[model samples]
Target: MAMAVQGSRHSDFFVEGEVYCDTCRAGFVTNVTTAIQGARVRLECRHYMSASGSVERSAEGTTDATGHYRMELVEVDNRGAELVCAVALLSSPVPECHEMEVGRDRAPVTLVQDVGLATMVRRANPLGFLQTMLARYADTDTRYVDTKMRHL
Candidate 1:
């Protein structure tokens, strides 16, 4: 679920990433992981206009069948100020996997053009949901007695 920032001919920037369900509540993707469709993602940018002033801009996008989402940021004026941008999870359509994973809910993106990079593409971290019931552990009585009771 890494995010990449790309530049378009129209001068607008595009941010892309993926949303998934942490089936086993693991931080990273696993063999049993599932993609989350219809999940809402947001790209937010904040810039300091002056010592006492600041502004924020945001764009929203939804995950496709493949759990991929891309958002275009338009009307963005750096104004000599560094724009701090990040992609975050907004909402998930899956009722059982709607809770946001702490520390992994947002990914920072570099949008500055003066980094001396040959390409506009930049990679980032991931955002995903954890299964509400830990279905994989439903049958296990080792650590989750309550959950195992429900399954029994």
Candidate 2:
């Protein structure tokens, strides 16, 4: 006797994320950080062996006032091959925060799955850029002095 198993199928997947400016240059998004408006973001999918050697499919959307973006990707059948997908930052309107950070530029996400589900929504981590230094900004003082040494 042999047994067979069945799994659920999904027709599409959605990727959602946010973009922000690292005010303190903390390298990550924080509550104090502000959302970047009019920022460009893109979702790219690439296959290993393509004659064109370009992105197979791509979709772009700009950030809103709240710096939130959502992209819907159609389920692609790669015929047993892996399909690479990632959400990357393209540009920022704010000149002060236009520099892209090292690891925060692009975030890889899984778009294809065989598990049983009607629809899958993946939430990507926040991507951010370092803000330019201001003329009058300064770090807090951390120096300490010994009172006894002063008396000596």
Candidate 3:
């Protein structure tokens, strides 16, 4: 007869990677010529999209001390599906500065199609970036950019 072994529930979590600056072509990390210190970042994910411009359930997350964030929306019990990475920016209001600082800009989100569940290994709790920063934005008067910076 097979004996039952006690175990704890395990969840699949993925580390949200850091964002890169297009102008600098460098990692959005804060300092040390790599990851920035006191820099802010976020992760947004959505199910696959079709040609009709429709969307499905999506989740978001944030980075931690090691510049990695985690998200655990997908479950092995839930049918296997793909997800994508959306948005990378110079985050604001880091722990030292819980509020947005002057001269710092929030980068526009750049969605990547291939960031699915397959690329990562599931961990009980991911390290690096925090699961989410929950940083508040636009508390003050700030207008959304009407155009891209590529030309400027």
Candidate 4:
């Protein structure tokens, strides 16, 4: 006789992501990203048929020393509908990197039960901020005038 193993009925799902400071001002997060500590992030969810038509639920968390954050979400029951979820950057504790970068502020994730995974874990893309310092140009003493003569 073969015995069947049953999975736990109650489980928790999680959303994980990282926040970084774009030190190079490259407008994107690269391998050499500097992780920001104490950065605030938020997770929002919305149901399609809500009366107010706004976000149904929201949760917030802060980044650790490594600029990583994880937020726990209630296990979803995908009986016949879907829920839309998104993770967004709230604020950065670093004064210089506090401004949110456009197009890199939020990331969307889907939470469904029929994915065949024992545990649900979603990862959002790295969000970043632009550099605060302005560009500098060097002054040169050498100067040239435009010559009127043209060679044929």
Candidate 5:
């Protein structure tokens, strides 16, 4: 099933990154990597707090093999933020698992290479959101960004 991307294509601005095991700092490498699959990878961009309490969220998603996943950030004015990108392995195909949080400064970023942890989260899309925005911004007729494309 094709998901409706506001633009003709999803871009590099779409964030995503890698995942690693705490004990083994390698890619979730090996055949028995079941524990790392289906993990929740989240990235939150908190600006300097709005007058209201609406702290902005940059993106969020889950991880697949190659130990990778992606998330899209939806914002108007691009001001960087303190980002918290995290991964949590859930339910016992393994056993008691806790969440791990990796914080870093984020601009219009696409990838977060491996930090010290076993896994990492990066901007999933290779083209990024702005590329899609351009399609909308350059619209000769209709606005495309918010337009919903059919899947079937």
Candidate 6:
């Protein structure tokens, strides 16, 4: 879920990241976690060029068989402007692992090149999804029900 934002030679930007399922329900990737193929991811950005107005940009991508996706933003000139971007989970192919992690669902990224980065690549923190929570009812019949609405 780590997003790597790269600036190409033509000023086009690339938003790259991987999607994974938290099999251990730990809210983070573990050794036994598996990649989520066909998962959807989105990149949203807002550029504040001046105090008068701002511009919004967005792009979507789907994860491949290896759970990797790269979205392209063409002709994005964010230099000398305040750019705020974030990558978020859109959907998961696995039904059991469709629960979005509370705080790790969206990852903030820096797209500007004024941060003293040695290269044109800027990396953001990891984002992930957790397995659906299940709970057994207190009644005699033992059946697990989805606890999606229940705050953990």
Alpha-carbon runs more than 4 Å astray in model 1:
1-10, 48-55, 78-81, 121-123, 137-152
Per-candidate Cα lDDT values, in order, are 0.75, 0.75, 0.35, 0.73, 0.38, 0.70
Q: What is the lDDT, from 0 to 100, of the residue 91 in candidate 2? A: 98
Candidates sorted by TM-score, best first: 1, 4, 2, 6, 5, 3
TM-score of 1: 0.75
List runs of model 2 lying over 4 Å from the truth: 1-10, 48-53, 78-81, 115-118, 135-152
Per-residue lDDT over 1-152 for candidate 6, one digit per residue giving the tens place of the 0 to 100 score: 12344323546667788788776677677897788899988888766554643548788889888778888777667452467788889999788778886678888776765557654454556567786544212332333333433434
Residue 42 lDDT, candidate 6, scale 0-100: 85
**What is the clash count for each candidate, in the order shown?**
0, 1, 14, 0, 22, 0
Task: Provide the global lDDT of candidate 3 against the true structure.
Answer: 0.35
Q: After superposition on all CA atoms, what RMSD does each candidate show versus the true structure?
A: 6.6, 9.2, 11.5, 8.4, 21.5, 7.1
- Tens digits of per-residue lDDT, candidate 1, 2-45, equal 23343334345667888999987778888888999999988776
Better of 4 and 5 by lDDT: 4
Index of the highest-TM-score prediction: 1
Q: What does candidate 5's lDDT look like per residue over 1-152, in tens digits?
A: 35655333432245565443432222223443223445555554444455553546544566676456666654423244333323222221112223232221122442333333333324332110111222323545443433533321
Candidate 2 per-residue lDDT over residues 26-94, each given as its tens digit: 888777799999999998877767767688777787889998988877655643146677899999999
- Model 5 CA deviation exceeding 4 Å by range: 1-12, 24-35, 49-54, 80-152
What are the models' TM-scores?
0.75, 0.72, 0.36, 0.74, 0.40, 0.72
Error of 3 at 59 (Å): 2.8
Q: Per-residue lDDT for 51 in model 6?
A: 66
